[model samples]
Target: MAYGVENALAVCCFMTPEYQESKNCQKELLYADEQNVPIIPCRIRSDWKPSSWLVPELPTKQFAHLAISNKSKSGVLRKTFLIGNTHKELTRKTAHGNTSEWTFFVRPPSSDRDSIETYIKRIRVYLHKTFSPPLVILDRSPFEITRTGWGEFEIRVIIEFQDEWHHEDLEIFWNLTLRDNESYEEVDVEFDSYL
Candidate 1:
Protein backbone atom coordinates (compact mmCIF):
# COMPACT_ATOMS: atom_id res chain seq x y z
CA MET A 1 0.00 0.00 0.00
CA ALA A 2 3.03 2.36 -0.22
CA TYR A 3 1.60 3.96 -3.33
CA GLY A 4 2.68 6.93 -5.37
CA VAL A 5 -0.21 9.37 -5.52
CA GLU A 6 -0.33 11.44 -8.69
CA ASN A 7 -3.39 13.21 -9.98
CA ALA A 8 -5.38 11.28 -7.37
CA LEU A 9 -4.28 8.10 -9.13
CA ALA A 10 -2.54 5.76 -6.73
CA VAL A 11 0.24 3.72 -8.30
CA CYS A 12 1.81 1.01 -6.20
CA CYS A 13 4.58 -1.35 -7.16
CA PHE A 14 4.37 -5.13 -6.90
CA MET A 15 3.31 -5.34 -3.28
CA THR A 16 5.06 -7.24 -0.57
CA PRO A 17 4.05 -7.58 3.08
CA GLU A 18 6.80 -5.15 4.07
CA TYR A 19 5.54 -2.41 1.77
CA GLN A 20 2.20 -2.34 3.55
CA GLU A 21 3.67 -2.42 7.09
CA SER A 22 4.05 1.30 7.65
CA LYS A 23 1.33 3.21 9.49
CA ASN A 24 1.63 6.03 6.95
CA CYS A 25 0.96 3.61 4.10
CA GLN A 26 -1.98 2.21 5.99
CA LYS A 27 -3.43 5.69 6.30
CA GLU A 28 -2.86 6.41 2.62
CA LEU A 29 -4.60 3.19 1.66
CA LEU A 30 -7.59 4.01 3.80
CA TYR A 31 -7.75 7.54 2.42
CA ALA A 32 -7.49 6.41 -1.15
CA ASP A 33 -10.15 3.80 -0.59
CA GLU A 34 -12.44 6.41 0.88
CA GLN A 35 -11.83 8.77 -2.04
CA ASN A 36 -12.58 6.06 -4.60
CA VAL A 37 -9.35 6.65 -6.44
CA PRO A 38 -8.12 4.13 -8.98
CA ILE A 39 -5.19 1.93 -7.98
CA ILE A 40 -2.75 0.76 -10.62
CA PRO A 41 -0.49 -2.09 -9.66
CA CYS A 42 2.85 -2.19 -11.49
CA ARG A 43 4.80 -5.40 -11.54
CA ILE A 44 8.55 -5.44 -11.32
CA ARG A 45 11.06 -8.20 -11.00
CA SER A 46 11.48 -9.50 -7.48
CA ASP A 47 15.21 -8.82 -7.75
CA TRP A 48 14.82 -5.28 -9.09
CA LYS A 49 16.00 -2.68 -6.63
CA PRO A 50 13.94 0.30 -5.56
CA SER A 51 14.26 3.36 -7.75
CA SER A 52 12.98 6.94 -8.07
CA TRP A 53 10.13 5.75 -10.29
CA LEU A 54 8.57 3.93 -7.37
CA VAL A 55 7.70 7.21 -5.66
CA PRO A 56 6.11 9.65 -8.03
CA GLU A 57 5.98 13.43 -7.72
CA LEU A 58 3.14 15.13 -5.87
CA PRO A 59 0.03 16.01 -7.81
CA THR A 60 -0.75 19.56 -8.83
CA LYS A 61 -4.23 19.00 -10.18
CA GLN A 62 -7.38 18.03 -8.29
CA PHE A 63 -8.13 15.25 -10.73
CA ALA A 64 -5.35 13.05 -12.08
CA HIS A 65 -4.66 9.61 -13.51
CA LEU A 66 -1.70 7.27 -13.19
CA ALA A 67 0.24 6.00 -16.17
CA ILE A 68 2.84 3.37 -15.31
CA SER A 69 5.38 2.73 -18.03
CA ASN A 70 8.60 0.80 -18.22
CA LYS A 71 11.33 2.43 -20.26
CA SER A 72 14.30 0.72 -21.77
CA LYS A 73 17.70 1.06 -20.12
CA SER A 74 18.39 3.96 -22.48
CA GLY A 75 15.07 5.52 -21.45
CA VAL A 76 13.85 5.95 -24.99
CA LEU A 77 10.51 4.45 -26.07
CA ARG A 78 8.35 2.74 -23.46
CA LYS A 79 8.41 -1.03 -23.51
CA THR A 80 5.28 -1.29 -21.41
CA PHE A 81 1.59 -1.49 -22.33
CA LEU A 82 -1.77 -1.20 -20.57
CA ILE A 83 -4.46 -3.64 -19.48
CA GLY A 84 -7.92 -3.22 -18.00
CA ASN A 85 -10.18 -5.06 -15.55
CA THR A 86 -13.96 -5.30 -15.30
CA HIS A 87 -16.05 -7.32 -12.87
CA LYS A 88 -19.63 -8.44 -13.33
CA GLU A 89 -21.96 -10.91 -11.72
CA LEU A 90 -22.33 -14.27 -13.41
CA THR A 91 -25.78 -15.82 -13.48
CA ARG A 92 -24.21 -19.13 -12.58
CA LYS A 93 -23.00 -20.08 -9.14
CA THR A 94 -19.64 -21.46 -8.14
CA ALA A 95 -18.77 -24.10 -5.59
CA HIS A 96 -17.61 -21.40 -3.18
CA GLY A 97 -20.87 -19.41 -3.36
CA ASN A 98 -22.38 -16.62 -5.46
CA THR A 99 -20.02 -16.40 -8.44
CA SER A 100 -18.96 -13.03 -9.71
CA GLU A 101 -16.15 -12.93 -12.25
CA TRP A 102 -13.59 -10.32 -13.18
CA THR A 103 -12.46 -10.01 -16.75
CA PHE A 104 -8.98 -8.77 -17.74
CA PHE A 105 -8.66 -7.22 -21.16
CA VAL A 106 -5.97 -5.48 -23.18
CA ARG A 107 -7.81 -2.92 -25.24
CA PRO A 108 -5.18 -0.51 -26.41
CA PRO A 109 -6.40 3.03 -26.90
CA SER A 110 -6.00 2.46 -30.58
CA SER A 111 -4.74 -0.20 -32.91
CA ASP A 112 -4.72 -1.20 -36.58
CA ARG A 113 -6.07 -4.40 -38.09
CA ASP A 114 -2.78 -6.22 -37.94
CA SER A 115 -1.95 -4.96 -34.47
CA ILE A 116 -5.25 -6.16 -33.06
CA GLU A 117 -4.74 -9.67 -34.32
CA THR A 118 -1.23 -9.74 -33.00
CA TYR A 119 -2.42 -8.63 -29.62
CA ILE A 120 -5.06 -11.37 -29.51
CA LYS A 121 -2.55 -14.03 -30.40
CA ARG A 122 -0.04 -12.72 -27.92
CA ILE A 123 -2.61 -12.68 -25.13
CA ARG A 124 -3.75 -16.19 -26.00
CA VAL A 125 -0.24 -17.54 -25.70
CA TYR A 126 0.31 -15.58 -22.49
CA LEU A 127 -2.78 -17.00 -20.80
CA HIS A 128 -2.38 -20.57 -22.01
CA LYS A 129 -0.83 -21.88 -18.83
CA THR A 130 -3.24 -20.41 -16.32
CA PHE A 131 -6.62 -20.31 -18.07
CA SER A 132 -7.80 -23.83 -18.67
CA PRO A 133 -10.00 -24.42 -21.74
CA PRO A 134 -8.35 -21.23 -23.04
CA LEU A 135 -9.82 -17.78 -23.50
CA VAL A 136 -12.44 -17.18 -26.17
CA ILE A 137 -11.39 -14.75 -28.89
CA LEU A 138 -14.18 -12.76 -30.51
CA ASP A 139 -13.85 -12.61 -34.30
CA ARG A 140 -15.45 -9.18 -34.55
CA SER A 141 -14.99 -5.60 -33.38
CA PRO A 142 -12.84 -4.57 -30.43
CA PHE A 143 -10.48 -7.41 -31.11
CA GLU A 144 -9.08 -8.59 -27.76
CA ILE A 145 -8.73 -11.68 -25.65
CA THR A 146 -10.55 -11.91 -22.34
CA ARG A 147 -10.43 -14.37 -19.48
CA THR A 148 -12.71 -14.63 -16.47
CA GLY A 149 -12.13 -16.06 -13.01
CA TRP A 150 -14.41 -16.53 -10.01
CA GLY A 151 -12.07 -15.20 -7.35
CA GLU A 152 -9.61 -12.35 -6.97
CA PHE A 153 -6.14 -13.54 -7.77
CA GLU A 154 -2.95 -12.07 -9.11
CA ILE A 155 -2.42 -12.89 -12.76
CA ARG A 156 0.69 -11.92 -14.69
CA VAL A 157 -0.37 -10.05 -17.84
CA ILE A 158 2.40 -10.07 -20.40
CA ILE A 159 2.27 -7.55 -23.22
CA GLU A 160 4.26 -7.46 -26.45
CA PHE A 161 3.35 -5.09 -29.24
CA GLN A 162 2.91 -6.21 -32.83
CA ASP A 163 6.20 -4.71 -33.94
CA GLU A 164 8.02 -6.48 -31.15
CA TRP A 165 10.32 -3.48 -30.82
CA HIS A 166 11.25 -4.50 -27.30
CA HIS A 167 12.75 -7.92 -26.81
CA GLU A 168 11.55 -8.50 -23.28
CA ASP A 169 7.89 -8.88 -22.40
CA LEU A 170 6.35 -6.29 -20.07
CA GLU A 171 4.48 -7.93 -17.23
CA ILE A 172 1.57 -6.41 -15.31
CA PHE A 173 0.69 -7.99 -11.99
CA TRP A 174 -3.08 -7.63 -11.86
CA ASN A 175 -5.18 -8.59 -8.86
CA LEU A 176 -8.61 -9.23 -10.28
CA THR A 177 -11.21 -8.53 -7.63
CA LEU A 178 -14.79 -9.70 -7.80
CA ARG A 179 -17.37 -6.92 -7.71
CA ASP A 180 -21.06 -7.32 -6.95
CA ASN A 181 -24.11 -5.13 -7.51
CA GLU A 182 -23.69 -3.38 -4.19
CA SER A 183 -20.03 -2.57 -4.84
CA TYR A 184 -20.23 -1.66 -8.52
CA GLU A 185 -21.18 1.69 -9.95
CA GLU A 186 -22.19 2.63 -13.49
CA VAL A 187 -18.94 4.56 -13.80
CA ASP A 188 -16.72 1.54 -13.30
CA VAL A 189 -16.69 0.56 -16.98
CA GLU A 190 -16.23 4.17 -18.01
CA PHE A 191 -13.32 4.47 -15.60
CA ASP A 192 -11.70 1.22 -16.71
CA SER A 193 -11.29 2.35 -20.32
CA TYR A 194 -8.65 4.87 -19.31
CA LEU A 195 -6.49 2.23 -17.70
Candidate 2:
Protein backbone atom coordinates (compact mmCIF):
# COMPACT_ATOMS: atom_id res chain seq x y z
CA MET A 1 0.00 0.00 0.00
CA ALA A 2 2.85 2.37 0.84
CA TYR A 3 4.64 1.46 -2.40
CA GLY A 4 1.47 2.05 -4.40
CA VAL A 5 0.90 5.43 -2.72
CA GLU A 6 4.51 6.49 -3.40
CA ASN A 7 4.25 5.89 -7.13
CA ALA A 8 0.71 7.26 -7.52
CA LEU A 9 0.19 10.66 -9.12
CA ALA A 10 -2.50 11.58 -6.62
CA VAL A 11 -4.16 9.62 -3.80
CA CYS A 12 -7.92 9.56 -3.57
CA CYS A 13 -8.64 9.27 0.14
CA PHE A 14 -12.18 8.07 0.83
CA MET A 15 -13.20 9.73 4.09
CA THR A 16 -15.15 7.34 6.31
CA PRO A 17 -15.25 6.30 10.00
CA GLU A 18 -13.65 2.90 9.36
CA TYR A 19 -10.94 4.39 7.14
CA GLN A 20 -9.87 6.83 9.87
CA GLU A 21 -9.66 4.09 12.53
CA SER A 22 -7.51 1.70 10.49
CA LYS A 23 -3.76 1.70 11.36
CA ASN A 24 -2.70 0.71 7.86
CA CYS A 25 -4.68 3.60 6.38
CA GLN A 26 -2.91 5.99 8.76
CA LYS A 27 0.50 4.70 7.63
CA GLU A 28 -0.42 5.13 3.97
CA LEU A 29 -1.61 8.70 4.55
CA LEU A 30 1.57 9.56 6.49
CA TYR A 31 3.79 8.05 3.84
CA ALA A 32 1.97 10.00 1.13
CA ASP A 33 2.40 13.22 3.11
CA GLU A 34 6.12 12.57 3.62
CA GLN A 35 6.53 11.98 -0.13
CA ASN A 36 4.79 15.32 -0.91
CA VAL A 37 2.00 13.63 -2.85
CA PRO A 38 -1.31 15.37 -3.35
CA ILE A 39 -4.20 13.83 -1.38
CA ILE A 40 -7.72 14.37 -2.72
CA PRO A 41 -10.28 13.85 0.01
CA CYS A 42 -13.48 12.17 -1.14
CA ARG A 43 -16.56 12.04 1.07
CA ILE A 44 -18.13 8.58 1.05
CA ARG A 45 -20.44 9.20 3.99
CA SER A 46 -22.07 12.61 4.25
CA ASP A 47 -21.93 12.75 8.05
CA TRP A 48 -18.33 11.55 8.43
CA LYS A 49 -15.55 13.95 9.39
CA PRO A 50 -11.78 13.63 9.90
CA SER A 51 -10.78 12.98 13.54
CA SER A 52 -8.03 11.50 15.71
CA TRP A 53 -4.77 11.12 13.73
CA LEU A 54 -6.38 12.53 10.58
CA VAL A 55 -6.97 16.00 12.06
CA PRO A 56 -3.45 17.24 11.37
CA GLU A 57 -2.93 15.49 8.03
CA LEU A 58 -6.13 16.51 6.23
CA PRO A 59 -6.79 20.14 5.51
CA THR A 60 -10.09 21.91 6.10
CA LYS A 61 -11.57 21.98 2.58
CA GLN A 62 -14.74 20.94 0.84
CA PHE A 63 -14.42 17.23 0.19
CA ALA A 64 -15.56 15.83 -3.19
CA HIS A 65 -18.63 13.64 -2.88
CA LEU A 66 -18.50 10.29 -4.67
CA ALA A 67 -22.05 10.10 -6.03
CA ILE A 68 -22.87 7.01 -8.08
CA SER A 69 -26.15 6.69 -9.94
CA ASN A 70 -27.27 3.77 -12.08
CA LYS A 71 -29.14 6.15 -14.40
CA SER A 72 -26.22 8.52 -15.07
CA LYS A 73 -24.94 8.28 -18.65
CA SER A 74 -21.31 8.12 -19.73
CA GLY A 75 -19.26 10.88 -21.34
CA VAL A 76 -19.92 12.28 -24.81
CA LEU A 77 -17.29 12.09 -27.50
CA ARG A 78 -16.68 15.25 -29.60
CA LYS A 79 -14.41 15.84 -32.55
CA THR A 80 -12.41 18.92 -33.56
CA PHE A 81 -11.03 19.20 -37.06
CA LEU A 82 -8.60 21.58 -38.77
CA ILE A 83 -8.67 21.94 -42.52
CA GLY A 84 -6.19 23.98 -44.57
CA ASN A 85 -6.22 25.14 -48.20
CA THR A 86 -3.26 26.84 -49.80
CA HIS A 87 -3.25 29.07 -52.87
CA LYS A 88 -0.27 30.61 -54.62
CA GLU A 89 -0.50 34.23 -55.83
CA LEU A 90 0.32 35.14 -59.43
CA THR A 91 2.31 38.14 -58.16
CA ARG A 92 6.03 38.38 -57.19
CA LYS A 93 5.61 36.37 -53.93
CA THR A 94 7.61 33.13 -53.42
CA ALA A 95 6.10 29.66 -53.07
CA HIS A 96 6.74 29.58 -49.31
CA GLY A 97 4.88 32.87 -48.93
CA ASN A 98 1.68 31.52 -50.49
CA THR A 99 -1.52 32.42 -48.60
CA SER A 100 -3.36 29.62 -46.80
CA GLU A 101 -6.89 29.57 -45.43
CA TRP A 102 -7.58 27.35 -42.42
CA THR A 103 -10.81 26.53 -40.69
CA PHE A 104 -11.14 24.96 -37.22
CA PHE A 105 -14.36 23.23 -36.20
CA VAL A 106 -15.80 21.68 -33.05
CA ARG A 107 -18.48 19.09 -33.86
CA PRO A 108 -20.55 17.11 -31.39
CA PRO A 109 -22.26 13.79 -32.09
CA SER A 110 -25.74 14.20 -33.60
CA SER A 111 -27.37 12.44 -30.68
CA ASP A 112 -25.67 14.74 -28.13
CA ARG A 113 -25.98 18.07 -29.94
CA ASP A 114 -28.85 19.36 -27.83
CA SER A 115 -27.03 18.75 -24.55
CA ILE A 116 -23.82 20.35 -25.80
CA GLU A 117 -25.62 23.39 -27.15
CA THR A 118 -27.46 23.87 -23.88
CA TYR A 119 -24.41 23.69 -21.63
CA ILE A 120 -21.79 25.44 -23.74
CA LYS A 121 -21.73 29.22 -23.36
CA ARG A 122 -19.02 30.23 -25.76
CA ILE A 123 -15.93 29.13 -27.69
CA ARG A 124 -12.71 31.09 -27.74
CA VAL A 125 -9.90 30.61 -30.22
CA TYR A 126 -6.42 32.06 -29.74
CA LEU A 127 -4.31 32.64 -32.81
CA HIS A 128 -0.72 33.64 -33.49
CA LYS A 129 0.55 36.98 -32.23
CA THR A 130 0.99 38.26 -35.76
CA PHE A 131 -2.73 38.21 -36.40
CA SER A 132 -4.74 41.34 -35.65
CA PRO A 133 -6.90 40.75 -32.54
CA PRO A 134 -5.68 37.20 -31.91
CA LEU A 135 -8.63 36.28 -29.72
CA VAL A 136 -11.92 35.21 -31.30
CA ILE A 137 -15.02 34.40 -29.25
CA LEU A 138 -18.09 32.63 -30.63
CA ASP A 139 -21.26 32.57 -28.59
CA ARG A 140 -23.41 30.51 -30.95
CA SER A 141 -23.42 27.20 -32.76
CA PRO A 142 -21.23 26.24 -35.75
CA PHE A 143 -18.25 26.84 -33.51
CA GLU A 144 -15.48 27.50 -35.96
CA ILE A 145 -12.44 29.69 -36.60
CA THR A 146 -11.42 30.81 -40.09
CA ARG A 147 -8.20 32.62 -40.89
CA THR A 148 -5.96 33.23 -43.85
CA GLY A 149 -2.22 33.24 -43.16
CA TRP A 150 1.13 32.68 -44.78
CA GLY A 151 2.69 30.46 -42.09
CA GLU A 152 1.88 27.60 -39.75
CA PHE A 153 1.50 28.00 -35.96
CA GLU A 154 -0.23 26.51 -32.96
CA ILE A 155 -3.78 27.56 -32.11
CA ARG A 156 -5.51 27.26 -28.74
CA VAL A 157 -9.24 26.54 -28.43
CA ILE A 158 -11.26 26.92 -25.22
CA ILE A 159 -14.88 25.84 -24.76
CA GLU A 160 -16.56 27.55 -21.82
CA PHE A 161 -19.68 26.22 -20.15
CA GLN A 162 -22.64 28.15 -18.75
CA ASP A 163 -22.30 29.58 -15.26
CA GLU A 164 -25.06 27.37 -13.91
CA TRP A 165 -23.29 24.19 -15.03
CA HIS A 166 -20.26 24.65 -12.71
CA HIS A 167 -17.92 23.12 -15.22
CA GLU A 168 -14.33 23.93 -16.10
CA ASP A 169 -13.60 25.25 -19.57
CA LEU A 170 -12.51 22.56 -22.04
CA GLU A 171 -9.22 23.45 -23.74
CA ILE A 172 -7.85 22.01 -26.98
CA PHE A 173 -4.93 22.76 -29.27
CA TRP A 174 -4.59 22.62 -33.06
CA ASN A 175 -1.71 23.24 -35.42
CA LEU A 176 -2.62 25.70 -38.19
CA THR A 177 -1.09 24.35 -41.36
CA LEU A 178 -0.72 25.42 -45.00
CA ARG A 179 -0.87 21.86 -46.27
CA ASP A 180 -3.88 20.72 -48.30
CA ASN A 181 -5.04 18.23 -45.71
CA GLU A 182 -7.43 17.84 -42.80
CA SER A 183 -6.66 16.97 -39.16
CA TYR A 184 -9.04 15.62 -36.58
CA GLU A 185 -8.88 15.36 -32.78
CA GLU A 186 -11.42 13.91 -30.36
CA VAL A 187 -12.17 14.46 -26.65
CA ASP A 188 -14.57 12.72 -24.25
CA VAL A 189 -16.40 14.94 -21.73
CA GLU A 190 -18.91 14.11 -19.02
CA PHE A 191 -21.54 16.68 -18.11
CA ASP A 192 -23.78 16.63 -15.05
CA SER A 193 -27.50 16.73 -15.72
CA TYR A 194 -29.79 19.17 -13.95
CA LEU A 195 -32.67 16.73 -13.96
What would the TM-scores of all predictions be?
Answer: 0.36, 0.50
Per-model lDDT: 0.43, 0.68
Give a tens-digit lDDT track for model 2, residues 1-195. 877888999888877777778887788777888888888878755667778677777765457987744345532223333222223223444455545556776766556536456767898888888877999998887777666667778888888987655568988787765564566655665554421
Error of 2 at 184 (Å): 1.4
Q: With candidate 1 superimposed using the best TM-score fit, by how many Å does residue 2's alpha carbon deviate from the native?
A: 59
Clashing pairs in 2: none
Q: Per-residue lDDT of 1-195 in model 1, one digit per residue for the tens?
A: 434453555544343334545556556645665566755444332333333333442233132223333332232332123455667777888665647665555653443223444433354323434566544433433534444455566555554434323234445555555653312111101111111
Measured on C-alpha atoms, candidate 1 has an lDDT of: 0.43
Candidate 2, residue 29: lDDT: 78
User: How far out, in Å, is residue 125 in model 2?
Assistant: 1.0
Residue 121 lDDT in candidate 2: 84
Candidate achieving the largest TM-score: 2
